[model samples]
Structures are given as structure tokens and as C-alpha cells.
Target: MQVTNQPIDAIHEEVFADTTSGIGPELNLINPQPESCRQISAESPVLSNIELAKLKNIPDFEAATIPMLYKVADGGAGLKQALDAIFAAADKYIAEGKCILILSDRGITKDMAAVPALLAGAGMHHHLIKNGTRLRASIIIESAEPREVHHMALLLGYGVSGINPYLAFESLEHMCADGMLDISFEKAAENYISACTHGIAKILSKMGISTVQSYRGAQIFEAIGISSAVIEEYFTGTPSRLEGIGLDEIAKEVAMRHEPAFAEQNIDPFSYESGSHYQWRNGGEQHMLNPETIVKLQQACKTGDYKLFKAFSKQLRGSAFANQNLRSMLTFTP
Candidate 1:
């Protein structure tokens, strides 16, 4: 029930955490609807170099500038290498009087896979915390991965001071140019940020949290499918009861994205995969409430047939697909 637009707190090293419930239909970040997320949006001042590239026009974003930036040597070096490089850069940056460290996947190439931004951010955070030097400087992310509220919340929770959501901004620009969005690009980007902040507030309010300072690094939820080893290492101190996946799963997921990004095949770059998270897509991710189930329900309603209804219900609830939730993992015992 508590709420505040401006969050005030002295966030030491304990401001980053991985408390999200990982049992979504896919392995995307899911802020529980019940708990209210704090901050709404990060209000802290962050210095960054991204202004030289993208994000040069947003009002009130260019508060400061970064003197030094760190990055992985190559994107095709695999996930482990990328992480190692990031951690190494962390130590060097901290030692060199650098106040803001930028972890970016922008240098990744097509030969190898991409490291999930969540992993990079969370890994660097814990690494710094373990070394007892996390509070030395802030972390900023310059990537194309984060676009939605949940994505931004995860970044904030994992200890990033600010995010240069260049991809999201570019998408808005494209939408404006293509007439998909009625407003100007700047207005669309501002609205997107507003939407993310409000969405995060809704999640924090569900958990009864009042501010981003309290919510940052709080690790508010439990992991449903991720493994304990992964949580201990990256999400450290967060709960993973099911012990589901490890680095292998994460690597595979990253490859799924990396493979298509640089493929030399003849396909439209704009024709991206229509992931069926909300509405269903052809040859895409399967959803419980898909068109097939909807038609069956309609047919059963029209005929008043119990058997038809049962079939529809069974298919809707007990079907198998890549998108798995906690609901399908449960069973009744005698």
C-alpha cells in the first residue's frame, strides 16, 4: 500500500539481488503481480558514454559522462570467456579510479554466442561484492537486451545504476517512421520509460515495498526452474527450489538468439520471430489459451456438450510445449 515517486536510500553493496520467480512460460524475467516493486524507475544520476552513440536526445539523461569503458575482447569467445573478461575488467576499472563500469554485449560477433545481460550484470555485481569493492563505482549497461519493465527491473535489481536501452529507443524510432506509432520518436521513448516505471511500481506494491532503495538487491521472489548452482553463483542468496537449469540451459538460450542474429541465410532481418507469449503465432511458441482451444470452447458452448467441454479443458490445461509454468509442474497425489 505504500508508494513514492522518488526513492531515497544509501544503497551500499547490498542493493543488487535475484529474487525473481523464474518459472515463466519462457525463461524471461517475471515480476510477480502480487508484490509491489519499489523505485518505479531509477532516479540516481549516472555518467555514461552511450550519449556519443544512441540516447543523445532524451531530456535529463545526459547528467554526466564516463571517462573509461570496459568490454569483452570478442563476442564469439563463448559465455565463460565473456564473463571472465568482464570480471577482469571490473578489477582493473576499480583500481584505475574509474567510478562507472559499463558492461556491454555490443562487441559480440556472430561466431560465438551472446552472454545474457542478466548474467553479465549479476555476475559482475556479485564478483565485486565478494571482493569487497562493489561500492567503489556504479554499473551501467549499454545493450539492446532490455526493453520492457521486467527487464529493467532485473537490471536494477542486479545492480546497474543506469541503462542505455538503445534498442528500445531505436525500435520506437522505427515505429514512428513506419507510422505504427502515432506520436514522435521522443514521445514514444518517454512513454515506454514511463510504462516500465509504472509496471515496476505495480510489482513492488504487490510485495508491499515502498522504495527502490529497499527493493534493490532484495531478491524478492523464488526461482522455480533454475538450478541452485546457477543461483548461488550469479543470483547468489536467491532461492531456487526446483534446481532446474544450469549454465548449459543459459548457453543454449543465448545461442538461440545469437545464431539468428548473424546468420548469413537469406531472410528478411525485419522478419523477427513472433514469440507467442501473449497472443499465439504460427510456428512460434505455444500458449495455453491459443486459437485451437478458443475454438473448441466455442464449439462446446454452442452444443452444450460436456465431453466437448472436457476435451477443451484438458487440452487447454494439460498440453505440452516449450513454455512451462508452475501450474503444469503440479500433480495430485492420493
Candidate 2:
């Protein structure tokens, strides 16, 4: 959020100029391409070399207008190699000691914790970053999705309190524009949204409130004897920038289960205690159907249970495709 109107071209040159002098090795300097020379030289003063490198590698980095989304390939030396390449690419550009933002996939998040290595790779000493305000940087290894990206873009624009969402988005966008990642904007946005929703659901379940029923005065209504109204208040009061963006519909469905009306509406046709009805009081609402029904649905989805998965997918109105939450849980293997 803290940025100076320092000309982008000036910033770029200052960063590369000092480092480009008397370059001793290929790994030490980036050969500034002519295309890069014509673009903005200066960047926001706060970005780090590594962060800028990641941004520069985003797909279509040269002309990225929309938000960028980078994909970290699953389970290979691919991620490490990609990181190395990006660093190599930006070594000179970022050497100017500019601050840069970096948003990575969850898989690479652990790497951020190893600050020492990052500093070393950027040819800087650890102690140099001791000043908090001067070296301010953010590394978030959060879920990525199209909706999440869009929401993040909006949040970055909002700049509430002291939280600046744009740094993360800019890092991500730059990386995407630069072609360092193999992910698409839409897919990234979807993944981001799914991460947020599922993450919140997971957090709520741990708190014994499995459903998020509202975002205003009585959001996140719980099962059992808890009041749905209180949960709504909690959610609305939380002040998360993500509150109203892409989660309204999800909240309504999750909250509906806790409503007294849901209890009355659910009816069982079979003679069993669970019958055909699902109740939210006993974590039933956490799921879209009765627990007993879900058990069968899980089985059906697994063993080529196309008939069941299809029907269930229909009932859930294609959430399987949009969110893939159920599909992931059911397809998961040991």
C-alpha cells in the first residue's frame, strides 16, 4: 500500500544499473532485453529482487493488463527449477533493492519461511532486512482461483485499515504476465475462492460451527442450540475484505441449514431414524444431505458411481464442477 510515484523507468534502471556493472557470471546479471528497456524502468521502491523476478515471469509479463495468475506444477522438481529460472531472469532487475510482492502456491509457501536462503540467493545479507518498515514484504501461499483473484484485486484496491491487497495481486499478476507460471487466470481465481471457502469451513468446523450461515449480524449459524443470528454477527463483524465479494451465495446455503424452518421442512419417508431427511443440528447440514445419504453418495461417486455422482452433482447444482469440493473429497486416495 505504501508506494511512491517514482517513475517506473527510473526505478528499473537504478535497480539494473548498479548490478549490471562488471558482471562476472551468467548467474550474476540479467541481460536486459530490448523489450524490457522500452518499458517502465522504476518500480515501487519496496520490492525485493526475488519478488520482482517472480512478477516478471508471469505469463505475458510483457503486456499483462488483467491480473496475472501463476500455476505451480504439482509434485516434481518443476517448482524449484521454475523459481531458480525466475530468480536468474530478474537478478539484475531486482538488484536495485526495490521491494516486490510474491504470492505463491501452497506447495511453495514453505519456501517463504526460509528467508535466509531467499536473501542469500538475491545476493543480500540477512541483517540488511532487519528494519521492518524499510524492508516490508508479503508472501501469502493462499488458495488461488478466478473468483479469489478477482476478490483479491478488489481488496487490494480497497486498502482498508493498513491491509494492502494489491501487493500480492501485483506480484501474482507480474509473475503470470512474465510466463513463469503455467496457470490460467480463471483457474487461479477458482482455486483461490475454493481455498477461502473450504478454509473457512474447516476453521468453523473446528470451532464446532460447521456452517457459515450469514455474513451480517447472525452469520455462521451453528447447529444444535446456538443461534444463527449470532453467527451472522460474527461473520459480518469480522472485517475480512473477502466478506461480500464471492461468498454471499455460499453463506446463504450454509446458513439455511441452521434455520428453524430447515428442521420443519426436512421429512423422512423411510422407516429409519435418518429416513430421507437431513438435519443440521447433528452436523447434517455441514453436508448437503443426510449423513446416511452422503455415505451412499460417496460410495456411488467412487466405484464409477456415475449414476449417483451425476444425480448428486445435479442436486448440488453443479458444485462439483464449480468448486470441486465434493469431487476432491470423494476422489482422494491413500
Candidate 3:
């Protein structure tokens, strides 16, 4: 029921996809007037119209806490632990007859690393599906991992019913404190939720689907660099045209954040590393088009040398940085 898609106006209106079943339109938990951000929470951020009011209801919401620290530094141990916990939570939910499973990565300390919520969520979803427990409980994630529309879409696409972007709300609060936002925190949060829900609706609309329920567990995404084994075991049925990294690579990537956060000697800046995937940096996220690649291409063109051009092309295919894209991994099929 998209009364209005405009951000501010939409917040005032009760515009949500159908949640309640066998209920009349008027009784579908519609909020006509302005309200607080009480609707926003770790569980059912996209409110299901089945409200879980009061803190006492937490007993029904089984929590699966993800840890940051592990026995190994490369984040393999930590990630493995989290994955095991998620799978275990699936079983626990089934055994206990629970309605909701909340996977949270909020156990933050000086010595902890986060298992990527997307990876964790998708893995759990697939695991539960394999074991015939996907519908046992609705998956709700309360974490700082998701902040953008892409994240939310991917989460829902892979089988997440609810998401509470806690960190984003904190950031919005900071912005409001610094006078960056002219509206109240509740209004900012409402606008943010509205934007995310609207963005999700647009994505689904592109797929010619009107409801989020149809998009849920659809796995309508293709992997570029992720390996076949990972897709088969974790992200089953998702297409991967050019398989790339596997578990080891994933662990190393997680370690990139984990190690820094848990390091004995704090990073001098105490900030996340800047990625150079967009523009080249001394030692940053790799990009296919960099100074060396550009220089090689320029030299090859200037001298009209096929060998130089071959070298340039070779660099594009051979170099680790260049292989980040699927195009670099493509080969001629005879």
C-alpha cells in the first residue's frame, strides 16, 4: 500500500507491504498520525504488524550472540564459531518451538572480530533450509553490519525477515547531536527506515514483484569472486559465472577487520582503513585501473607494440588486483 513514496510524507502515512493475513485493510496496524521511533528495533525493523511490545517479551525472542574473538587471528576460528552457533540456534529454535531467532553481533570488546552479518545470515538461512528448519522461526538480525539499502536488500533476499541497523541509528543520533540533522532523532530514524523500505520496494519492483514475501529466500543474486564450493554449501542455488575466492580468502578478508580491532597496539588513527578500490592509493583496496596499468597501456599505445599491449593485458588478467572483477576471470570457450 504505497500511499506516498516521498520520504517525509510517507512517514506520516502508514505505508507498508501486506503483513497481516486474513485481516481487513483498516485493521492492519496502520498508523495515520505522527509517532515516535518505537517501531524501530532489532526485531522486525520492518514491522510485521505482529507487535512484540515490552522488554518482558524478549524471553520468546531467542538470541544467538556472535563473538568477535577466536582462537586464531585470521578470523577463521571466530567465524566458524559464529557459524556453528547459528546452525545450533536453528536446531534450538526448532526444539524449543520458538517463533523468532535473533542473530546479534553486539558483543563488542577491545579483542573481538565480527563475522560479516551477510555471510552469517545467508549461511544460516541455507543451513536451516537444508535441514528443513527454514520456516521454524523468522530470522531477525540486530547488528551494526547493515547500514545501506544494498545490505538490507541482500539480507532480505537471502532470507532475513527483520533487520535493526543499530550502528546507523547511532550515527544518525551523532549527526543530530552535531546539528547535521534539522529533525528530531525519531524523525531521522523514521526517514531512514522509510528510505530503506522504499529502496527495497524499488528493487523488488525491478524484479516485477510487489511484495517482500515473494523476494524472501529467492537467492536472486549472482556471485562474482565467491567460489563454487562456498555458493553450493552456503549460498545454494545462487549463480556464480566466474568463481574466485573460497573460505581461506574469506577468512583473510574478515581478519583484515578482526586483527586491527583486536590488536594489542591500537591503530594510531583508531579508524577503519581507507579502501582504494575507487582510486589508487599506496596500499589500499585494489582497482583494475591503476597507475601501473595506465602506464603500461599508455606505453603500449604510444609505441604501437603488440607485446607491450599483451603485457598490459596480461597484467590485467594475471595481477591479483585485476582479478577482482568477473571480466578479468573470463576465458574464451571453444
Q: Superposing all C-alpha atoms, what RMSD in Å does each candidate have to the true structure?
A: 10.1, 21.8, 8.0
The Cα local distance difference test for each model comes to 0.61, 0.31, 0.66
- Candidate 2, overall lDDT? 0.31
Q: What is candidate 3's local distance difference test score? A: 0.66
lDDT, candidate 2, residue 323? 46
Which ranking of candidates, highest lDDT first?
3, 1, 2
Cα error, residue 48 of model 3, in Å, equals 13
- Report the alpha-carbon TM-score of model 2 versus the true structure: 0.20
lDDT of 1 by residue, 170-221 (tens): 7888989999989988788667765666566555555556455456656666
Per-residue alpha-carbon lDDT of candidate 3 for residues 1-334, written as tens digits (9 for 90 to 100): 3222333222332354432111001111354534322232432235321232232165544434333233335355556776786687568756776646666677665555566788878888898878876655567667787888888889888987777788888888888998999998878888887778777767666665555666777877988878898888778899887777876777788666556666687577636666665598877767778899999899999999999999888887775755586566568998
Clashes of each: 17, 57, 1
